[model samples]
Target: MDSIDEVLGELPLPPYVTAEDVGFAVKALAVHAAEQWPDGPRCRNDRAPHPCRLHRWGQRVLDQRGLTDRQVQVLIAEQQAPQR
Candidate 1:
């Protein structure tokens, strides 16, 4: 069985990385985070494989923006925090 990613292919990156794109990417990473399953890790949001299309796309966006792993983590943390 082909994975959803294989069927749909990768999501396209932005033509130019912008602050808004970075914010969307951060949200994607947070929402598409992995969860442990009896079979294996899978996407928490879609039940697809872990590192699903959106997750990979988010990583690519952040990479294009030259964000470090630490910086990405911080952004994700902020994204998950409660909004005032």
Candidate 2:
């Protein structure tokens, strides 16, 4: 973990996961997708380590909501789709 991560700790989960929270989680996962770097993978959005705080938080939220991996993939794909 990076210094900032160590200092700040993980993002907190909501007391209750809701559809709106799922939407935000999907957006976070999509936007924070990994990027290949010379050193290694990093967060595409924040340039932090792969699976940065927000990404991990989003995943946890999805998992808590009982979403399967395939479902998460579909959500991410839909989030990434271009608007008409």
Candidate 3:
């Protein structure tokens, strides 16, 4: 099976990264977050290996935004956290 990253590589980039692109990136991250598996926290969104396309895309966008790993983690946490 091809990894999501591989598929992502095949994807063509849009003319430019816009706000809509950011939204898609966020969705990708949330959808492709790791899941707790019997073996380990594998990618739940896609069965095609860990760090799926969406996940990678999200991380890339976050990176472009100048976020560190810790910062991305916090952002993701906030997204998943309960909205009060």
Compose the digit string of candidate 2's lDDT tens values, residues 1-84: 668999999999999999999999999999999999998999999999898999999999999999999999999998888989
Model 3: per-residue Cα lDDT over 3-84, one tens digit each? 4455447444455677667667677778787887776666777664557666776767766766687876666677778999
**Model 3: CA > 4 A from native:** 1-23, 36-41
- TM-score-better candidate, 1 vs 3: 1
Q: Arrange candidates by lDDT, descending.
A: 2, 1, 3
> Candidate 2, residue 31: CA error in Å?
0.6
TM-score, ranked from best to worst? 2, 1, 3
The 10-residue segment of model 3 with minimum total lDDT is 1-10
Tens-digit per-residue lDDT, 1-84, candidate 1? 126567788899989999999999999999999999998888899888788888899999999999999999999998788999
Clashing pairs in 3: none
Clashes of each: 0, 0, 0
Error of 3 at 58 (Å): 0.7
lDDT of each: 0.91, 0.94, 0.67
TM-score of 3: 0.65
The most accurate candidate by TM-score is 2
